[model samples]
Target: MTRSSIRTSLLALCAAAVCTVASAKLPAPSPEAAAKAAEAAAKAAWAGKVDNYKLCLSQDKVAAHYRKTTPSANPAAAGGAACADPGPFAYTPPAAKPAEAAGAHSPPGTASSPPSTQVPAAAAAPASKS
Candidate 1:
């Protein structure tokens, strides 16, 4: 093969290898890891909100300054929506239900009954004729 063809083949092979590695399934996160991930995600979301709030406040201040300095033919509207302040970062982890409360093993009211109440198949059958 020509040098260009060889390079193209190698590049295609490398691309395929990268795609295979990227598509490979990742192992499920442990419960603790999952909880930490959830908390991190919550924190990131709150941080984004805080950033947006700060941006809004800064924009309002700039607008007010501009209005004071510049004379306009027509005054801007008197009222607009106020900038919301995201007070604090607080994340409350969801409560975990106890195993008993989860009711995974059996439905409600069945726990009082015995383990097995049905008679054996052979015993329940009538005796065969001679």
Candidate 2:
């Protein structure tokens, strides 16, 4: 390469480096500049799709599912329980017994087990040594 070309290349590289450093040290863009940049970006983003931007965005999101990382399982997180091999409803209704079967059915005129007498015999008993 000629001396002039070599010097030109070095000058170009130096200018680029100076601009990069200066830009890094510069204050953040003003609100107006930021808004302008955002407007420009948005225009560029949906350049052709002024009407069908929503459809385009939805399609892009669907395509991006393949590129997205699978979320890692968190031990502490609660997850919905779904039956992989669902059979019949797992919940069985409580076995229905007639009130008469459990014990003598209280007459309609009387109240059922009074609150004071509601304690079971085992619970009413004092704690026993094993």
Candidate 3:
């Protein structure tokens, strides 16, 4: 093949690959489809916290956690949107939730306070018959 022909073929391959990748990504959904998807995502995200989501304008606590952790770049309030934070390590001892609160248990001797509603009782046996 001539040099020009080879260059053209390589360019065409690159263009085709780009188009294929772009098409695989999400496209502009129709209004109805977009609304349906938004509704589904909202339902799934807020699953059991519809009331809190409505009241706070966000259903996910992950965003709140991020807001608290990151510092804001803009002078204005983030309006519930998350800003960047230096990190928990910036604090003297790092004010993080206790291991039990995060559902993590330490070794037997190193165990901290137990979580609320944690029952340490052993399984009860059936009552003896007369």
Indicate the residue-level lDDT of 101 in model 1: 80
> What is the C-alpha local distance difference test score of candidate 2?
0.61
- Locate the minimum summed-lDDT window of 10 residues in model 1: 70-79
Global fold similarity of model 3 (TM-score): 0.21
Per-model TM-score on C-alpha atoms: 0.69, 0.23, 0.21
For model 3, name the residue pairs that clash: 69-85, 70-84, 70-85, 71-84, 71-85
Off by over 4 Å in 1: 73-76, 100-130
Q: What tens-digit string does per-residue lDDT give for candidate 3 at 1-130? A: 9999999999999999999988896768996786678667655545545444454544335455666777773424446543232222221222457779766775557547665445534434455679
Note the Cα lDDT for every prediction shown: 0.86, 0.61, 0.59
Candidate order, TM-score descending:
1, 2, 3
lDDT tens digits, residues 20-114, model 2?
98878667899678767866766654543443555555655654564454465343343333223322223323464687876667654666766
Writing each residue's lDDT as its tens digit, candidate 1 over 52-114 gives 999988887887777777788234553678878887989999998888789976677746768
Q: Top lDDT: which candidate number?
A: 1
Q: Model 3, residue 57: displacement in angstroms?
A: 34
Off by over 4 Å in 2: 1-24, 48-130
Q: Rank the candidates by lDDT, best first.
A: 1, 2, 3
Please tell me which model should have the higher lDDT, number 1 or number 3: 1
